[model samples]
Target: MPLLRSRLLPQLQALLDLLLPPACPLCGANLPQGPDQPPLCPACLAGIRPLESPCCPRCALPYPAEEGTDHLCEPCLRRPPPFAWVAALGLYMGTLQSAVQRLKFSGAIGLDRPLASLLADRFTDQVREFEPDLLLPVPLHRDRLRRRSYNQSLLIARVLGRRWGVPVACRSLVRTRDTPPQQALKADIRQRNLQGAFRLLGPLAGERVILVDDVMTTGATARECSRVLLTGGASAVAVTVLARTPRP
Candidate 1:
């Protein structure tokens, strides 16, 4: 029966594909027919610009030139965030931004697979180096979670954990309060809004955790989450996000 099921599943998937057809989530172009190719077309996939060298070693913000010096961003140099470092897949722009929006706002949960696969491939080296003991998705407030019916971060984190053989602690950290959207607020205001918003549910003493989120704008949300985790006795926290909005 197990062998029969394995043989039938592909035939079923092929039938579904032929019936519904798959289009690129970014551009609505017809995707190539195959199990090996990502849901995105070749052009859309090519447009994803991975963050490269000469970036802030702490924040992963791209620098303009290779000055031969690894310098921290002004914010990092001054106040310093709670997280030890950040690993972002790319800048929040182009097809990447579009894909994120669709998955986040439009209820396109199916996009999770491709996006997560992209992230895993892009940040495999950095994530391996960090060697976090656990993966935690930045939680959504109860109200927001009910309204959205899902946490996109958790979905992405599940994929990463499955692929990397890391255990994901989905409920270890949670949002204690619902705040207004951060995109509309200034950096200082964003920080203020996120204050006391997150809480750690279990002890993380001396454990390294990786926080997953869909996007990092001012880094305020990640900062607040990291603070709570550290206060709960986590030795260190690193952030992993799909994209980073360039500093204004």
Candidate 2:
């Protein structure tokens, strides 16, 4: 009976799928009927544009035009961030933005899987090349964590760590103070707001760390966290995110 049930399960699932078609989370479009396909439909998935070359090597900020192989944005040239490098999957717009909003504010925890998979696929070469010793998610304030019940950055980091065979140190870095949302503040104000906002829980001496997060706007949050990590004895720090907000 067990063997018969196992053999028939796929057929039963197919019937159910036919009766109730799956919908794309981003656009509410009908997803192609396939057990192995991602929850996003092809149209919605295509809307998430991947980041291309000619970006700032230090911050991964997309440039207006192709600007040779290696270049630095004005901010990086004037004052370099604490992290060595930044990599992102795509510009923060279209379906990518929608997905991030849903995962972050709408309590869609399951979105992390597909988002992380896309992150890994988009930057597997870079991650392998950087070869970080540990994966660190930007820590959230306790109050916010309590309210959200999860850190989206940590969720993405956990998935990437599993895929890349890197160990995740979720507790090593922590947000010691609650600060105003960076998005709500100007670049300079954002920097000031995050001052002394993070603390290192343990030694990261001589370690190469990769900071993971959902999105990068002005990069103030990543900078602050990287500063803390560096001060705690990390040799180098790199950043990876699901999306990056293009500069105006």
State the weakest 10-residue window (summed lDDT) of model 2: 62-71
lDDT of residue 51 for candidate 2? 79
lDDT of each: 0.88, 0.89
lDDT of 1: 0.88
lDDT of 1 by residue, 1-248 (tens): 99999999999999988998888876788888886867578998888777777778888777777565667988899989999998887888887888899899999998888888888887788788888899999999999999999999999999999988889999999888888989888777999998998888887878899999999888899999999999998889999999987656
TM-scores of all candidate predictions against the true structure: 0.88, 0.88
Q: Give the runs in model 2 whose Cα sits over 4 Å from its true position.
A: 1-23, 28-30, 33-36, 66-70
The alpha-carbon deviation from the true structure for residue 41 of candidate 2, after best TM-score superposition, in angstroms, is 1.7
Tens digits of per-residue lDDT for model 2, 1-248: 99999999989988988998877766777888875867478887889888777788889898777556658999999999999888898999988998999899999988898788878877888888887999999989999999999999999999999989999999999898888888888877998999899999888779999999999998999899998888899999999999988877
Residue-level lDDT for 173 in candidate 2: 90
Q: What's the C-alpha lDDT at position 141 in model 1?
A: 93
